[model samples]
Target: YEFDATVKKVEEAMLSEGFGVQLITGIHDMFKKKLGIDDYPKYTMVLGCKPQLAKRALETSLDMGLIFPCSFTIYEEDGKVKVAHVSIMKIGAEIGLADKEAMAPLIEDTGKQVRRVWDKI
Candidate 1:
């Protein structure tokens, strides 16, 4: 039920945000075929980045490979699908940054985007 609920939330969010949904084969398919991660519904990461954020991030860092923008993955864990979110800013800080102010807004916005994504999930 949790997995189904999360999937539904994501679908509804995409629709509300006017983004298209791309459903790839579930992870179990690969497991049954190769890695043997069977019994779990694993799937490729669901990607949904707002155009505005994408544009801003690109303008901020031509190489802001850090903020490519993606969604938390949904996977079967302990017999349930769990949803999660990761932020580049969070990850970047762990690394090192010279300009914190310039990066602050980007990270803030990223956090907002993540929250919105979670709201849907």
Candidate 2:
């Protein structure tokens, strides 16, 4: 898929899954315009949020905010466009939270929604 088309699809999927795009950072363009390097592949990071989920997580532990606004990276590789994100399960485990029964559902739900966006595009 084309870059812009993929981006649009991702945005739509995120919204449909109850997440809102908080910001989009165009890494490729930044490097080109700032450093005059035009050889990089297209890449952008989508920062997203689901308000209720965020609120609950933060209420549980303020430190959780460090990973708030789940991020997905849209980039081109070998002439194909792909979307990638850190695994929420891994993140939770790393922070010693995934093992907690209460945290499992939230982590799973968030991962499901994020995967839905990737699959949609």
Candidate 3:
């Protein structure tokens, strides 16, 4: 899929997965407006949240809310469109903020959800 199509697909997949489409930021457009640069490749950020899951994470640890919404960055590189996201649960564990054993199920479930979204995109 092209850049626009991929972005739309991601939004639809996320919504179908029961996540709220929070925000879609046009990074390249912002750079053109704020920095007066037109050479940057296309870049956008789509942020989504599964409120219940986020709430559960917070209940486990308030600090977990620091990165409440999950994000997927869509951009062009070497003329190829790319989509990517990071696992917030993994980040929290790696950074020693979340207990690995305690967040095991959440992480697994989140991975499954992400995988579904991936299969769609």
Q: Which is superior by TM-score, 2 or 3?
A: 3
Better of 1 and 2 by lDDT: 2
Per-residue alpha-carbon lDDT of candidate 1 for residues 7-82, written as tens digits (9 for 90 to 100) = 6777667657654455523556777889766565565456655667566656655555564545556677777667
lDDT of each: 0.61, 0.78, 0.89
Highest lDDT against the true fold, candidate: 3
lDDT of 2: 0.78
When 2 and 3 are scored with lDDT, the better candidate is 3
| Highest TM-score against the true fold, candidate | 3
lDDT of 3 by residue, 1-121 (tens): 8999989999999999998999999999999999999999999999999987898778767888787689999999999999999999878767777788888888888999999988888
Model 3 spans with C-alpha error above 4 angstroms: none
lDDT of candidate 1?
A: 0.61
* Candidate 3: clashing pairs of residues: none
Q: How close is candidate 1 to the true structure, as a TM-score?
A: 0.69
lDDT of 3: 0.89
